[model samples]
Target: MSGHSLENLASFVRDLDSACSALMIEGKNLFAGSHEGVLRCWDSATGDLRWSVEVAGPISGFAVDNNRVYTTASDSLHAIDMSSGELLWSRELEGGSDYVKASNGFVWATSSVYELEVADFIEATIWRFNENGDELERWIITERPWYFDLHKDGGALLGLGRPRCGYLKIQPGEKPSHHQLQTESPVTSGCRSSEDCFLLGHADGTISSIGSDILSDSDSNSLVTDIASLDLELISGHDDGSIRMNGTQHQILGSIDSVTLLDKDGWASSWNGSDTQITILGDTTNTISHNARIRQMHSSDERLVIGDELGRLFFLEAEIVKRRRSEIGELDDDENKNSEIRARLRMLRNR
Candidate 1:
């Protein structure tokens, strides 16, 4: 159990075909879907197959809660039991679905394809469901709304359009309202506000914070990719192969947080797009981490599990470190090692 080593937990059925589109984990097992139309479940810690099912389309999105595993294909959605892999309920949707988040007793999602094909019309929708697979409500807004934030408070939904453009707020039954907080550049990628505020990364390397009032303009051109807010600081992963800590109180850099590089097995080189996922613990200023390439990830207060594209999973115990020196000179013996770590981090962020 080295600090940075990945362990092979399990592999999916062969029909999954060496390409994992999305992955999810339940209590003690791992579930994955491939570019092919196979959904396979394996022991979370041992990589042993529990069950496999062939669906109508490629696996697009997945979520797990207790004994029930939920997923979305091109034209359909499914809920299956974890133990026996029995199909419990199946529903249908219009197009392809991309991401799904299960929390606060709901499954929230966005579309895999939101590009406009019709002359002047494109539809991106969010569907809500109950535990028993009943469709609760749905909303259609914008031409292509991808990433979303379903706030813990009620049913508040936050949607992002193409970058440099602004974002929207979707209340239960009200018309979607725009924030109009124009960006310095097109926002290439973004994540939900792990805290009360939100983070957006622009195409030109600008990272900004949006508060509740929607008029606050606090941003920096730091070339950041993914971010997580913790305590009173923002932990950001950058395209420059570095992770920095910025002060939320006065809006400035606190220090050059932690630096990490790609591992030896080409895990960092495999990242394809701006889809890396980062989550931070709200209580600690140093516990920020992420995973790329659609692997399963989970974080509690004490531990984290990162599953990779190669079907290897890494379990890490949390470590909180402080800035031991001033940020001024060239690499020392220890800083030289840290530089390599930062290089790997940048490659992941840029990809």
Candidate 2:
């Protein structure tokens, strides 16, 4: 650990994987689905290869639930068992499935909108499926949904696109309700921070929070620093750990080019332009540099994992940066309490 600590914990480079494509971090297991059509899982504890499997090429999306890993490549959706890495099911979708989400007993997929050759127009399809592999409903969206996140409290799903953005609320045994949000410049990325509040990244280098209140000046601003100057959303990372966006556990903001998540120590790196600098959300002075521009970024509790087009994966771990937060002090999430529980679970995995 570095002696010069920010807030409480010093952020340091933990490890690097020279070979990487699409990456996901679930608990202590880090999953990488490469453009080479290969998927790998590593034991984050020892940085050991837990299991590796070869799959079809150019994976566009990767996700995980309690039991399995869901992936999309080409127009196909594949589910692999979390423990054994065995293929449980695979299905093909119309057009090409560009994004996917699995949560609250349902799996969702969306296809790219623009024509394959020309980015001239937008037309896309969204598909929903149940655990038994039965197709529930498919809807068409005028603006493509490039990314999605499950509402933390459940009963709803969040979707993002350039021209439009919205959330679909699903009630038990009832039709889902969808609502559209207004945005100037394209809404490149979005994620639900809490039940009442969500954050969105816009193409003009801006991130905004949309909650029950529609007219709060504090809701929108150019907080992305260098990224704001270069309206790009290159890669995205999901909040699957203890890090809080903007110091609150529920607030998460994202752009299309780079994955942006906030925390007490600042933020995990996401990109807006060709630059390779990772900005700490509020602390613009502190940044970790990379040789290549970041194409994808993901996170665990303490680890920020990023992949570049150069086929390399870089990782940074902030020593629980939340420990140093002044006003908030420490993270109030269950991570501290769950550490004892996960320690016990780790023992089982070793066997």
Candidate 3:
């Protein structure tokens, strides 16, 4: 364990009109979608704006392949050309599109309908389409899926809710199969660690694995809010403002909002009303606090991208972050300049 410190600050874009709701990083590009329905792409290395586009509604999620980016806005799924940011096609889905993933030359999306009278999601549908935006198949389920991941076989693995209380497996052009678990809590978050391994977290703070022999059951006594995996290591965030890495618990500032992996290290972000904290887990753990709440985060290789509630986007690199922390550690005892340095180290772009 290492002492927690605030240091890293990187390039940022602060012109968004609403909170950033979704983020994805691929290759040299960083993609962000906002609550105001604005989607923008930036060069991950230079922080230069590549393009921006407006869609039908607030962007909920995004999926990117080699040539296209697919996003779910309102009840419609929009496909945009990756390079030019031109709209290629848009298709309306019943209920509302909540999640989207692209793999193996195909796209998969999930939509759910909420029953206001019951105050819960009543049904959901899984849709599959080709790269050309043509629908191929769909399967409807009675329970809403709390989480889903794309399987290596080009199918969808869904963590289901009440009545099922387990998982569902949907293969391409085949009938859906399901296995019910005899548990009181539903799966809340999950991630595909490898081609053959999937880890799932439950509301009762239990962690389970499918197809992996290394993971064993662990309990945290709080709801698992998010999970991210790299190779064989697993990092999970909980509702109790704690993070578990391979069953080792680390305390943070607030309840965790999201967790992700930048290269081999695991990063978790949490919000406690006035500030947002981003903690890195590895050989030497570090945490950075920000003024704005982070809405979404994603990473690629050594680079990290963050979208915050104040509509700002930040880009940081692992080596640069370490270097910045080292620079901060050498500051002198001048109060006035130290005050300015602390402001800059908050990681918010000074406007």
- Specify the poorest-scoring 10-residue window by lDDT in model 1: 261-270
Model 3: residues with Cα > 4 Å off, grouped in runs: 1-8, 11-15, 181-184, 329-351
Model 2 worst lDDT window (10 residues): 226-235
- TM-score of each prediction: 0.59, 0.67, 0.87
Query: In candidate 1, which residue ranges exceed 4 Å CA deviation?
Result: 1-17, 25-29, 42-50, 65-67, 103-106, 112-121, 182-185, 192-195, 210-225, 228-351
lDDT of 3: 0.79
Tens-place lDDT per residue, model 3, 1-351, is 122233225544434557898888889888888888999887777766788999866788888887899999889898999999999999899897889989877989999999999998889999999988899999999988888878877788999877677899899979889976545578888888778778888888777777754434555578889888877677889999888887688987779999988766788889886788888887778777777787587777877787888777777787876666556343345744755664564445322
lDDT of each: 0.50, 0.55, 0.79
* Model 2, span 1-351: residue lDDT tens: 222222123231222223355777788777776676777777665556677666666777787876788888776888888888888888888776677778856887777655758664377766778855688877766666533656655544544454555545554355657666554545556555555565665544345555655321222243222111111122122322112333233223332235444333344444345545444545433454545656666665656666766554444565445343332334345645554464455455434
Q: Write the per-residue lDDT of candidate 1 for residues 1-351, one digit (tens) a residue.
A: 112112211121222443566555555666767666678776655545688887876677777666677788766778888789999887776567655656645665655344466543256677777767788877766545434565555454453545325666666556777665556454544555455567665545556556654322334444445444434444454454344444332122222222221111001111225433322322332222234353444333433445445433344334411121112343456745764575465345323
Number of the top TM-score candidate: 3
In Å, residue 236's CA in model 2 sits off its true spot by 12
- Residue-pair clashes, model 3: 0
lDDT of 3 at 307: 80
